[model samples]
Target: MGANDLAKGPQMRTVIFDLDGTLADTSGDLIAAANACFRGLGLGDLLDARHDAGTALRGGRAMLTLGFSRVDGVDPGEVDRQYPVLLDAYARDINSHTFLYPGTMDAVTRLKSAGYAVGIATNKPEGLAETLMQSLGVRGEFASLIGADTLPVRKPDPEHHFEAVRRAGGDPRKSLLVGDTATDRDTSRNAGVPSVLVTFGPGPHDVRALSPEATIDHFDELDAVVAQLIG
Candidate 1:
């Protein structure tokens, strides 16, 4: 695992989170970085901060691919070429407009106080995830941090989620993933665990259609939902 961090806790169950859309609304900054890359190529802000928010959370490559698709005469390998550029630009202003979802830390505190191990499993790069958590002053809240680049594989793969749960000192059979995307739904399903998708993330309607074990309207509903699913 690259840049993954772990901690031990006495808990039989764990709640792993998907960082981008679930815990934090990082679309603004993500789009900015993607736009920065497009600007460097004289494309001039191919992505709109508000409109392309969903694509932004999908990851840098997706954003680049989308932008490339919109224009004529763009090279096929442009997305790959601009990926590192996007990452560097993103690192420069990772948290400029990023913010934790309402009641996020409060719910996390409740979970931790209630003896549930908490961790994050995200498709964002490991270093970027770590830097954002630290920048938001919430790095200490999670018992484990596993990012896309943390392992050779990522979300929608059972191993990625299992590693996060294991690192947090929780059993995979007793773990649940709280997230906002179909990839998360599949990860939990593949791992033989339940999932709780949040309705507050980008493309909430599509998320609902994925039909995870349950759905939450807000972080305030998380504890109850988690208890029902895994407790």
Candidate 2:
């Protein structure tokens, strides 16, 4: 019902994952899409994947804003106008360069085997998130996906995480959030759920500064970390 509700109800184990930079390295494709939009405007590739990886994970608007800032005449309005174009380009080739983090699927399988319901809570648009997961052949693996557009609010809005757990049929009180950004850490705190930040994301935030409940360098350590946090 609310953020407090996430800490109530029967204990039902669940793990909510942040898609980009957490479960998958989608920055390359994201940057490419943004670059495609800039190129269409005859501005050429405005952002580089290596340089703007963090912005890419933050989403299209962030990347567009950053790119537009670097150009001479582009403004927020132009960024807004080009946002849909970026999405269209991304949708056309969602999986061209996107890839799951190493050992992600194995960890996910282990979680499923251990009877923990798994779901996704990402800031990406709902349709794009669905498209990416389906294109990558892993849509069936997740019980639920709550994206930026899935509800009126998104992370660091805890309601997004709460809805994800509920949709997964898992009790929010027994849920853990696995992500790669401060936004996810805040979402977990707001939801009263333990947070685990992975070091593999494109974001530049120091995981130590975020002070998550736990930090993991690789998905290989996820099972033990999740068990320790919420099991």
Candidate RMSDs in Å, in order, are 4.7, 2.9
**lDDT tens per residue, model 2, 1-231:** 986885565466999999999999999999999999888888889899897899899889899999888888766698789999999999998998899999999999999999999999999999999999999999999999999988999999999999999999888888999999889999999999999999878887778689999999989999999999887
List, residue by residue over 65-171, the lDDT tens digit for candidate 1. Answer: 98888889999888889999999999999999999999999999999998899999999999999999999999999999999889999999999999999999898
**Model 1: worst 10 consecutive residues (lDDT sum):** 1-10
Please provide the root mean square deviation of candidate 2 (C-alpha atoms, Å): 2.9
In angstroms, the error of model 1 at 75 is: 0.5
Return the clash pairs for model 2, or none: none
TM-score per candidate, in order?
Answer: 0.94, 0.94
Name the TM-score of candidate 1.
0.94
Which candidate ranks first by lDDT, i.e. highest? 2
